[model samples]
Target: MNLEDSTALQFDTPYMVIDFNQSLKNMKKVQSFADQHGKTLRPHSKTHKIPLFSKRQISLGAVGVCVQKVSEAEVMFDGGVEDILISNEVVTGIKTDRIADLASRGCRIKVAVDSEVGMSSLNESAREVGKEIDVIIDVDLGMDRCGILPDDFPGFLKKSSGYSNLTVYGIMAYDGNVADESRSERSRKVASEVETLTKLCKDYERINGEPQTVSVGATSTYDLWAEYDIITELQPGTYVYYDRRTTEYGASTMDEIAMGVVGTVMSKTHSNHAVIDAGYKSTSIDNGRYPILIMPSGDTAPVTSMSEEHTVCSDANQLKIGDRVLLLPSHACTTTDQWDKAAIFGLNEKPGTIEIKGRGMRE
Candidate 1:
């Protein structure tokens, strides 16, 4: 049989591989932590972008999945994800209408808004669908990315309050600014933001006469943020597949690092230097974080540089010709998006596969 047709054939350079056991463990552990803390776990599906992963997440007690785009939401809806939150700003027109259609199909849809345009678009779509859509006012806690200023939150909320067709649920303050390197510092910074934002949630309730659901923090600081007295929901995407940068976040141990790209060492040029078939195309090169290499002996190293079809590892002296290496990416989401599907590997059973159905479903 040809290599492509052969089940045991050597894969050409540059393919993505995911360890099923590691990925599942990451999902289970995070969900369990959320359950223990009484916070609803709504993982960002933008990480996996796979319906199978979404199904597994829901089965593990995730309240719902959070998606960044309408296209992603549509994919999740078809994948049997009954609930979704479009966590980013979705403008009016076709996309907003798409959101309405998904809701019409029995998918519970909630969206985040920060500007008058965003609120108007969401409200317009909701009214057209003749449904009361749940809305979360995204607050600019610190990221300065895309959220209404804290001082302007009330005015922003006022715009949506009167719309019976649009239910102002709460606020989503994503503290993506906090660096996870120093645990104490991460907790301190995240707590400060959470304190200020939770107060805003309380203040919103004071004015609106209803409790607000304040969602905050991320996977790196989920442990600290979840324990806080305020947050109602937790959105941690990378926790589904702990990556190199995240492992350094002190969020998970090496044993907990569950995702890697399996590649064969194509050349052993010299001592302590080997070239792997997987490269920048197969794995992500974020520049800020390093790619980890797991040797066949179960030991691991780091890739010094990554090109299109080649990854150079200076510490791979022990690695020999034809040895398969597993690479833990610097960024899990970006790296996983490079693949068409992930080969699920395990020790006992035949490797399974799942299509990355929405890999580039950016539309």
Candidate 2:
């Protein structure tokens, strides 16, 4: 939904705007893709951080939602999300207790464990609460940031039997590192990884029982991941509000992007030089690319530099003071975190704002 009809600039500058219709379209398209491939869509909530969107995703045939932090789980559970998978490890005692507490209150909490200490902490907490917490062994799968290596997974699984208050939910093998600029190369890497993951799951199930869950996929490899039956669920989050990187990877087109930071030109030193009120303080460049600037006329504006609260563009395309423009972030996940609420555009009537329910839930 674009504000094309001169009725769009009623709001203040430097607002995080969401195209409601486009966001819904993006969600539906991905959900349909997952359904066609017979995979459960458990979108990662870290992208939007709003429980309303999470519930909306669930309503559109998603099984539940995935979050990376215990605090994010708490926020979603409080927002009436019953099933949540904390797709990251919780090694701290307090955070583990929070997870156990949520479980004791009847929220289905599943967490990923990659080390003995994390599992032990979760086990102790769940034991105190007397609740059975589902645990998914995180397999490294070349990420190297977390998870146990594939060769040591069996030993890790063997060791987990001692934890009485925990159940092996399955495995979370995210091929996040399988990203390549070439679509064919990316597809090949994902297929190879999926094949290996499938063999591990099948071999383990042949001896033991079937793993309760097999969660994987990121937006970069979501389409390729859906082609395989090795996994039971998909965990792509950025599909909700694809950013510039999504376009660069060919996972999304420019029009499919549903998020942007709207900023007004506050100062124009020259016709080609203008300062936008939005900068790193409003959006982010963590993905190592400047936010793509678009004028009201839909022409691209080349950004020169971004400081705390101002973005200087060398080629403003004849934009002047008081003119409003949109800047699309390269990394939607990090950019979304900068705002507390989003000014919703493309609605039927006046714009409305929704709180970022899980914003700043880093703990």
Candidate 3:
């Protein structure tokens, strides 16, 4: 059976591959969006985990890339990605030292902070290295995750400013909970978020001088939030390789998704179920969602469940052993972390392998 990405079909089973052309298109589209809005594009690289992909984002006009951990920042820098923002908290001394070392070596590293401990440690590290580190105040718009709450942010910012080695230049207000599915509702919720972010930026400015940047948005709400002028940087991750979850959120179409796991059918033990050679270890089962299966015949199959090494399709009667299938992710970011390399094709140039340089770099 012939498929559109015939270049990837010949690869061994249970590997990740991307339609390079689609990936580039996605990059260019988002870059154009940022450029037209006068916003700086700093895509979060935690989705792809590959430094090469982060560099490609920079090449496509992204000001820089955002990473979640110090190791990812180091990987990006080592792989020739010049600028990085560790858009998450890093409080440990070892990690903070690593980040300071990167900044001292001219990596142009910045980090997001929600607590004074993060501030103290990073500042101390930068002091030891005799360098300054840019920091973004991470505020919780509603995600209830790592950011400081809106009510306590002014107090926190007052406490967060004593670090002479750290400069608070931006605000990282992630509205991950603003996903309402409806476009109008999404826009309304994002407008509320923008209002809150604008207030937070003013608070930051009042205490810490001028807030140079206001970073926000995910792939689901990037377009909606881009309409606002207060947002200066976009941190959308999954837009690089949108998945089933992104499609479910109306952020992208199934045809526009560029990444998938190529797995070969290994068993059809039951009449109604077919087991593929990939599972949660190969793809990702994040958010309790399984990958969507695409059979060799170019038809879609429903993935019922996945374990460590096997993905089972409960309604896969048309599939058989030896057939190759593409497993499109439900959540692209976590799914991308499962692989160490990707075979990219369809760029109109030579199809080749790209090392997933930041894969498994959780530190």
Candidate 4:
């Protein structure tokens, strides 16, 4: 349905809405950036979490998709994606077995391992399933998250060599901390991290032969890392649905934001404030800010506060009961995880629903 159609309000408020045309533009724009730089595009499926959109990304030139968990990988594989990378560590036995099961079922699945225990667990699980699993070594480049220390990476690789059921595919690093910095600052930080990554890859080659893939880069560093020949792949998920964070970080513009929360003004009792149906439960507050309100009249307002079911807007006095307002989340990835389905609309096609196949796949 046309966005302007009154019938569009039939759907309940606090629902995720995507501009299909803008999403297509976003997909192609990032894909083109990857293509121009001769880097493989493996857009992370965690942002959209929908198989349809992942397939669309593949159609546009993504080599495959990246997922953080085994369940998310299973959802994507079941949805017809052949090649998948679990970009995070899978430590639990059940999760590892699930990955092995997916591999045995003919899915080309690869997972990241940062510790010997993780690698051993995955190897044992794969052995139980009678299948070999490809793995990428996750090197910690200052994030201090889920990766082996750069200096200790060589030892980890050496230890991984003993796992017969695991095939070491390559190396992966995530620079999530640098995503919010200025472009130049982000580039500098990424370059410094890449130096460490490059050294680790070289050390890996010295110990384990040529590493097949040197995967790195998130949405914030996609363009920055694309200029480096060492990085073989780019794993950006948020670029598909640019949010206020991306726009503020200079990675994208407000006009390029494709996803929004459609919330209706529920109360306007105060002159300078109003309440919207969407709140911390509907949109994420991980960025320490509330979602921005895109008024129908092309104006904007800052969400002052959020409760479980209500978002207080600072300048929503123009809104009345039943007036719809679009909310651009501060962080798209977490906001997306809050939804079960997304209402998709395009310039030529009517609105439709796409299930968030990988929603709540935190396991």
For residue 174, model 4's alpha carbon misses the true position, in angstroms, by 0.3
Please, what are the lDDT tens digits per residue for candidate 2 over residues 118-140? 98999999999889998988888
Q: 1 or 2, which is superior by lDDT?
A: 2
Candidate models: Cα lDDT each: 0.79, 0.87, 0.85, 0.87
- Span of ten consecutive residues with least summed lDDT in model 2: 1-10
True-structure RMSD, every candidate: 3.7, 1.6, 1.9, 1.8
Question: In candidate 3, what are the lDDT values of residues 87-157, reduced to their tens digit?
Answer: 88998999999998998889999999988888899999999999999988898887889899888989998
For candidate 2, the TM-score is: 0.96
Candidate 3: misplaced stretches above 4 Å? 6-8
lDDT of 4 at 55: 91
User: Model 1, poorest ten-residue lDDT window?
Assistant: 1-10
lDDT of 4 by residue, 131-194 (tens): 9999999888988788999778888899988899999989999888898788899989988988
Q: Number of clashes in model 4?
A: 1
On the 0 to 100 scale, the lDDT of residue 5 in model 2 is 29
lDDT of 1 by residue, 314-346 (tens): 877788878777777888888878888876565
Number of clashes in model 1? 0
